[model samples]
Target: MARRGKKKGRPVSGWVVLDKPVGMGSTEAVAKVKWLFNAEKAGHAGTLDPLASGMLPIALGEATKTVPYVQDGAKIYRFTVAWGEERSTDDLEGQATKNSDKRPARAEVEALLPAYTGVIMQTPPQFSAIKIAGERAYDLARGGAVVDIPAREVEIGRLEIVEHSPERTLFEIECGKGTYVRSLARDMGRDLGCFGHVADLRRMEVDPFTADDFVTIAELETARFGEAGRGKPSSDGQAPQEEIRLPDRFEDIDALLVDTVVALDCLPQVSVSDDTASRIRLGNSVVIRGRDAPVEAEEACATARGRLVAIGAIEQGMFKPKRVFGG
Candidate 1:
């Protein structure tokens, strides 16, 4: 297949909370949405496996600048673990390497949840995106190389059983960044002595964005090109029916894009003066002094005239722009 050239698009900045469908890679989904919106620059906050689905927050234009903050936020995922078989990839996509007839009872699973909660050590699956010597771990594993991934501490706020069957167990987990649901399932299975793998997974929320904010691709298409369908026949039953025409303009697409400030909602907001905002934009630091100014050393979102100006730190009354948002 011949490679297609990139499309020339306007500078459209904002976040799109896409209810991504399963069986699509994160990169491919980002590309599709970028093309649909004709955005000049676009990126996604986190990677959802081709088998996983749900809230994939895509950052377009200036919104991409805040992707790191969003990615660092907590995430919620509901996944299923299929017992009796452990796969090489820790998910159904890979070959089974071990099996067992043992199945942990509901009570037994409940007792084990506490051990996995809080900060626990988790070894990422060999077939993961983690880098090993500058190469993807999955790529190395697929090439039949023995990959040894060390266990790292990950914070899990919550891990509970939503449902449990003889063949599979459903769980919902609220965890911090760098946590992998597949690895959780694998470790849980090992502890229960059933040897399992992730059968299904869906991210329900990612910090600031929840399932309620997600929009399907079809909905986006309709928003871009309004309700364009053949009108029904009149009472008199005329010839056929005229098609409903709707405005298809760039501004129409903009309506669907969320404000970039939504990504920084979790942080404290500091309203700055025009002069301070301009100085920050010019890569200069300004002193923030006022009753509402953030106290102590911490990160804050600086806004001027109701628009996000910069994300920076406040230390000793000085606000240093760590990442500035540009139009």
Candidate 2:
């Protein structure tokens, strides 16, 4: 194979919501956006199947740092279930194993839907990205080997029957991060004493994002070209530039993006003195004057408070590191 050449791209920092197109894998979409933005550092917050489409958060530049923030967020999808067959992949296009002669009505689907709501244990489909012996489970599945995958906990916050037909069923769901709609369809079919497979799947929303938040590759290109064409300055000598831009508006931009640190807005802010800030910068955990305790700098990452409970007002005063915690 020819050696891959040096990567050439611009660097952009911040999060950009995208409207993913169907039939394209999540990685493909992310690469396309990286090229569109010419950014060297970019990552997607969540993965969507080639058969699925909708709001996918693309982290550009430092925004990628917040991937964990939204990775576990609640998600929603609009999917179509074909009520007569089951496939190896749990969706259409895969080899099907079972078929049914009976048909299910919309009322029946609605009535059975409530059983999926709330906490539920679900078995992930064999054709998925789960790991088996440190290798992708899908790889083993495609090789024709059977894998006895175990069931895992996944929550379906809501499941609604939108439409039903003799040939197909369309429904929507809000579920936990790892819930598989394909598996849900298969299980639904089993419950109905028939067979079912996902005919179509489209993610409609993710935290801080929705179908309305997504941007397609075409749209991203258009936006870039639009910026390139915007030679007219705002005359205030403060418009914006392209290809490379800093997140000076970090506050507002992060408003649309998920927060790396949980409860940032709800947490109190302690003004660190020059010396204290310097010490914290050096990775030293220090104690704040108030709050009844001292904590490592990382602990502030949680709520700006140390190991102890948050005290009263936190004025603009210098603070030391408490403890290092997750963002």
Worst 10-residue stretch by lDDT in candidate 2? 306-315
Indicate the residue-level lDDT of 325 in model 2: 28
Model 1 residue pairs with clashes: none
Question: Model-by-model lDDT, in order?
Answer: 0.85, 0.67
Q: C-alpha displacement of 288 in model 2, angstroms?
A: 7.7
Q: What digit string (tens of lDDT, one per residue) describes model 2 on residues 200-278?
A: 8888877756565555555554454454433222222223354344332223323343333332322344544555545
The list of candidate 2 runs beyond 4 A from truth reads 1-11, 226-327
- Number of the top candidate by TM-score? 1
lDDT of 1 at 92: 83
lDDT of 1: 0.85
Candidate 1 lDDT, 1-327, residue by residue in tens: 999996567788899999988888888778877766767889999999999989899999989998988999999999999988999989989999999999889998899999999999999999999999999999999999989899999999999899998888999999999998999888888989998999999999998988778898777766665566233222222223555443447676678777899888888888888888899999898888789787655788889887899988888888888889863
